[model samples]
Target: MEQGSHLLFWKAVNTVILIAILYYLLKKPISRFISDGINSVVSRFEKIKQEKEEALNLLKEAERKSQEAKEEAEKIIKYSQELAEKEKQQIIAEAKIAAERVIKMADEEIEKEIYKAKEELKKFAAKKAVELAEEKLKVAIDVESNKKLIESSLQKL
Candidate 1:
């Protein structure tokens, strides 16, 4: 009975040592590998998140640029329209001024021509009156009646 008890005690001691060795060699190494893998996966996820954020910021910038371009185009169009309207008004004003100047010049020329014609008519009428008075004097005077011409011309004319 004493011999059997010693053998049983030795066996129990050996079983405890095997369990300690397995825990140190296999269980601890497996736990370390699983922890490293989990950390690697978390780091990859963080990298993807940063990339997504960068892409979103780029998209927002593009949209802002598009809106600015549209505003610039609108401003250019408005400026062109304003310039065209101003040109049209200026052209109309110039044409009206030119027409008025032409009409005024024509009226002045007509007045000058009329005044010149009146002066010529007056001179012609005075010359014709003198010629007609001489013709009437010759007809009233006779060749042998010089002494009595004044009394005869006064009665005949």
Candidate 2:
């Protein structure tokens, strides 16, 4: 029993001395390795953060461009609608003018036809009056009487 206790005490002292020696020998290299690992991890985290920011900027730019395109499309649609309305008004005006011109031409033609008919009626009346006067004269006077009347009218002239 005495020998076992002495042996146990010596083993405990040996284990403590061995731990102290290994710690002293490996401390600087272990600290350096741990610090390098921490620096690498920190740099990786910064790179990921920068890449996330860039992706967010790209997304914002895309959204802005999309908004601009939508605005431009709306403007184009409005312009087209206005242009079509203008063309429709112009066509209607032209049609009205053409209809007015046709009406004026028809009125003029009717006036001309009415004037020709009036002239023809006047000529017919004049011819009919002359024929009636000749018939009355023939019934009222003989050939001899017509010669005497002609000589009398000539003397008066």
RMSD of each: 8.8, 5.9
Model 1 — TM-score against the truth?
0.50
Q: Residue-wise lDDT of candidate 1 within 73-140, one digit each (tens)? A: 99999999999999999999999899989989988988898888888888888888878887877776
Best by TM-score: 2
Clashes of 1: 0
Provide the TM-score for each candidate, comma-separated: 0.50, 0.58
Q: Give the poorly placed runs of model 1, Cα more than 4 Å off.
A: 1-45, 121-151, 154-157
Candidate 2 at residue 49, lDDT?
96
Model 2 spans with C-alpha error above 4 angstroms: 101-157
lDDT of 2 by residue, 28-107 (tens): 89999999999999999999999999999999999999999999999999999999999999999999999999999999
